[model samples]
Target: MTSTTDHTQQPREAEEAREGEGTTGTGPDAGSGAWDDGLIARRAAAASATAGGQPVVPLLPAPHTGTPASGPDGADDDLTARLDALRELTGLSRPRVDAATLAEAGRVLDDAAARRRLSRRHTVVALAGATGSGKSTLFNTLAGVTISDTGVRRPTTSAALACSWTDGAAGLLDRLEIPGRLRRRPVQGPDGPGPLDGLVLIDLPDHDSAAVEHRAQVDRVLAHVDAVIWVVDPEKYGDALLHERYLRPMAGHAEVTFVVLNQVDRLPEDAADQVLDDLRRLLDEDGIALGEHGEPGATVLALSALTGEGVGELRDCLGQLTSERRAAARRIGADLDAAAERLRPAYVPTGRVGLSEEAREEFADRLAEAVGAAAAGQTAERAWRRNAGRACGTPWLRLWRWYEARRTPGTAERPPGGTPGAEATAARQRVEQAVRVVADEAASGLPTPWADAVREAAARGADGLPEALDGLTAPEPAPARPPRPGWWPVAVLAQVSMTLLQVVGGIWLLGQVLGVFTPDLLPPVLLMVAGILGGPCVEYGSRLAARGPARRYGADAERALRDAAAGCGRARVLDPVAAELLRYREVREQYARVLDPVGGDGARGRAGGRHVRVTELSTTGR
Candidate 1:
């Protein structure tokens, strides 16, 4: 039997030895007892960089095994990374995520970290059960001595009792608050050396004790222990408090649990099987997986701790557990799994957040409309045409307009400029509306915390937007009028020539009418008609020639106004929204890393990094 036990344990020990060299010694408890401050800072920096979507090499240490003195590979580094990620995530999602939820996650991390840094050599297994369940008797039976008080008392054990078959468990016992008086070392079994060496078996107070403190003490020990064997009697195997309050909540921790139907010796063989089946059904209802069909799950068996029946099987199971020395790592992994499940919704959203080009273009357009960019462009175009018309019109018309303007001094038309208060108010409202539309689109499908964050970012970016936009619309100082075209002079000269011909023709006609000269009437008549028709034609042709330049001038003004509006929109709204979405994406990816260090799906402890197999520890012992 000893040879067979060693045979079973040697392969695992060899595997652990080979994998032990892979430890990089950068974890929280790496190299020595002292903490690695430099490594902690690097991890913090990496987490900070992750929040900004920056790529960083997270130089985290790998996890060490239960026997840290030997430097085994326990995948402790992944948990540290996850803890850092959680810290970073919580920092980023503050006030958005519920305080209670964050507090729970914090508690889990704190407990796991504390437990991990303590003694890894001893596998602390608690035997927890209700009052008079024979747990104290079982504790003594396993220790091969009367280490715990057990009698007619309703609540046999008030405080925990610890029994170690090996040395180096003082630190662990101290952490458990087990007094020196209650600590013991086991004597040799009938065969010789105890089968369960290196195991720190804790006899916890009755879980359902009438005394509240006893029950509370039971809970405290259960929280810290590496594994638990629930000793239940035949009558109380389906007890509501045991199944409801403890077993169901700890369903994820099946790998570290053993449900023993103690006191089964009182039942007949056939009846015992029926009772065991019923107990299995109850555990299944509590969501605890059973290791019955060669699967990795909780171990369930019949054992009469008082009669010594089936006690050997239980010892064999525990011996396998202690020999493997992975109980601490397994329990920590299960704790991490529970914490990650609670935090999943906050970190992992339905889909990713993104900002598309179409949304950007639309936002810009809206902003331009809010500022009346197109209207300004049209006004500029018309102004250019009117100015050109005045510059290129006939001299006679110019003289008439000048005389009229002098008569009505204040009636001259002004350029399209000057933003009114009412118009600015309307424009401000439009700008705000445009901002809301884009912010909503960017935040869609994100969780409440991240969506809230995106909105806050947009708000901050747009805080001074309306004022900035108001400044953009303020009329620019009138520029020096552009130099006129050389053709203006030629057109003016042609008009002047037409006026001279008309003047000379009129004088000749007058002379003929007065009978002072007998010039040919047909020549004078022809000259008069040509001068009259030619002057108007030249003015009309000039107006038409200026149309192309006037249109281009208008287009340039429109483009400038729209471009200015678009730039303001991009600065105030688009950029910030895009940035928020990017941050969410990066943080979300970091969250994925926390959930699975290998950067994929499944429970963090099971799917990623080097971790104790859930079924391997529990099922192997059975």
Candidate 2:
């Protein structure tokens, strides 16, 4: 048995105050807040009432919300949970699913909640049909009184009328908006107790009436009723308006529906049977299944209110429905099924893909390429070589190169040879393409609207990315030209020594020619040859040594630029795409919960493992 000790621990006055926060009046437009408060209060009171006894109810959360509380039964919980899931799913899918598309679902939930809160014990059944269909006659026969006007009228029943077999249904009648004068109770006879003790029969306005308000009234009352008996005669049984507008759309509501062939007494026995068979065929075409071959579906019966042919059978069915006290729940479940079927396209997908590692890596690579990382590395290597030559070459050559640079028109230290504007434009294009690729992959197989939303998010994230990348690669004072190596001075000194030897040799030769000194020509010539050969060798060695460090410096520059590019891509595009995907996943789960009632696959009319099955209503009086 379910326990209510935790709930009972709270003071009664405090609990009442909390539950009564927003439920001052039970008006027609009170909305769902009043229903929630009423349901909570009733469930709490019921739990406390049965706590001391051996209650059959199991410990479960309330149906409307997932809050842990004692509930009446699992069937009620399942219906409530599915309704709650649908509401939440609709909210989560906003901007993707328009509010206008979900108007039917909203009405279904509001009506179910209002009905469930009013009175679960009473089974509210509506008699609905076209004008001159003998619905009022059948209703009067069922109530055993002349309550409704019956004649050869073109249109009747502009307002709803109610007849309760027992008392204490004022709340339910009020919810249906039935006028006080129109509400009636059956007079007690010598029979001790009637079969239908808690039945609330409603006579609705004619659906095919010319008056628009009468049709609107029929629609409003039908939405709130627990079950409906569609009364049709032989001629109008296959009317296209009735089938297309009502029967076809409510195919999921077969369990709570009964198709009656009224005025059968007007036809011969053979003709009556033929009309009934044809009516069954028409129902089949409208997607309403009959309880044939042991399957639970709608109950079809041929009857005549004038002769009282099948009134007893219909009463027995209503009696059974009221005794079980589950018609309201079954009807609510069917409404949920119909609403969910309409919404399946928006929430459920054929298939989908996620943000993969390969996609991210490819995006990063494209960004690196866009920023010209390879070109930057090559430039760094060339810069290193030029700086090294300036430091280690002979002083005269270095001075001449500097003078030549000053003479040139556009020889100032710049980053590279490319046009800055052109490179920036190409980089922007690559960045945009990368963003689109990743966004498409992430949104694959999603609904068209949601996919558009994901792509929009990616576009927003890519804004200003090109300018950011340019800032990272922009030139900034040439990095102070890397410090000279320790061995550079040794090479410079060797070159200077070679120059001194050549100078001294030339002077000696000149003096010899002038007869000022007695020197050999061989020594002077040999010194001159040594200076020429040594200078070239030193310069060659310096060039060979600079290759290793230049390569290392180029590699470092490439790695730093690539890292910056990858970071910018992640911050701008990838992260936003991932967030949108996560949100879609969350809403999808909510849809799944709404799709299934007993948390099984959402097959129509299958409520597995529940105490109350979805198709049990059709089999109630068989």
Candidate 3:
């Protein structure tokens, strides 16, 4: 039975072999050492020799196996473990690393974790390119099976294909939107060396001619993968559109890249070599290294799945990469870098707050102050009085009151309880107007988007106030509570007195006209008659004038307030802030996974140990 002891012993043995090979300096076995060290030394010597200097150093053989490496890949295991952790935390199947999307995602993950929003997990590798670039072919080759369809058709791949060696990895396929029908058989080598043991390979449609939707599909998947394999063919190898549009811009992702020259069999032998060389040079110019030795370069390989010429070599290279664990960690690092970049806008802490604390407080205070000034209670009472007066007071009583105000000393007229003071009504109006101005000002100076939200909110808040106020201030329709019975006594007396005075005066006037009575009595009689009719007529006209607009004005005010408040309440000030917050949370979670990993006996750890926390380490002291 396989035991923990066996797993532990394997790395020790590998380390010993590496040391031995390093000491032996002579045969094919002499070159083995730290993978990166050997690779760097060889590259340096090669460079020197190419300059026509004395042969600087001989190329060394990479250590075959057996090392105390941390991850499944011979690289950094800590980072890989963290990536896996992050993936699980985020509920995302894998970490995506690509030129177009990596930076944004990296920033988001970092900020999310810093804010304790979510966790992160494993790095996902996706193969993407134009049709006939052999992405499916390469995926099948890497997976060691004929999982994806490959044929002579112009566009062979119709949908995305996903292959993973880890058990229960089927969940990931579902997340990637890969249908079960496309799931392929796993290719197991001797000793159960499963293809893609710890890796998930996603084969996407050709980005060139597939339906626009297919291209969208490819882009969507690429956004989530941890690494990418950009497959290209000889005929279109130097296509400016491909390089300028896809390759050159991706120079930042050199570490997580594998540039494959596929369908090499189609090219003449010498021509193929020339093309490969040119490709390498171009990549170098774009700041992408060509071999595994460079610190920040992609691994380049020529392969033909049709002929199987370079298939095994590529497989072995992948196996070695997986076995080292550092590749996985690097992948996580790359993903973290990308996620951090995406979240930068939100997470970096905008030095200038959109609304300062003092400003917010000031606005709130202004709102409260305006409400106070509106004197709503006073307005309501005044409105109630006005209606009551109109409803209860008789016309005679009103005329008597008006007359008393002008002529009486202690017995001044009152509208039953009394008229509402003008000061209170004016105060109420002032408060309402103040509220409107304050609301408008508070909503101003915000970003257009935010300002719109504030305006909507303010309108909502003020929605019903106008209506409520209008209802209170609306005039009574008619005198529902007519003046008391006593009012009739005053009316009768005034009428009787006026009639007697007119009769006496009219007789005197007739006498004067007949040259019998004095002219004085005639003038008094005429004046009394005019006064009696004029008072009643003026009262009737005044009521008619005040009735119509008083009722309508209150109703209009109510409607206006209702509409404004409704609009204000509906406004959303927090949406933009909340959305940004959520985005930051998502990214921080991803970042955490890259920084810290949870180790378990899961498929994630099969390739190598998890990646080291290089980012944290680098920033730790600072």
For model 2, the run of ten residues with the poorest summed lDDT: 13-22
* lDDT of residue 372 for candidate 3: 30
> What TM-score does model 3 achieve against the real structure?
0.40
lDDT of each: 0.70, 0.70, 0.49
Candidates 2 and 3, the one with greater lDDT:
2
Better candidate by lDDT, 1 or 3? 1
Q: Order the candidates by TM-score, highest first — what do you get? A: 1, 2, 3
Residue pairs whose backbone atoms clash in candidate 2: none
Model 3, global lDDT: 0.49
- TM-score of model 1 relative to the true fold? 0.80
Residue 66 deviation, candidate 1, in Å?
Answer: 14
lDDT of 1 at 361: 83
lDDT of 3 by residue, 329-353 (tens): 3443544444433423322222222
Name the runs in model 1 displaced over 4 angstroms. Answer: 1-77, 91-99, 189-195, 412-419, 483-552, 600-622
> Which prediction has the highest TM-score against the true structure?
1
* Model 3 misplaced stretches (Cα beyond 4 Å): 1-107, 110-124, 194-196, 292-296, 325-329, 339-622
Give per-residue CA lDDT, model 1, range 115-191, as digits (tens): 66665667899999988789988999988899899999788788998998888888888878889998988777576
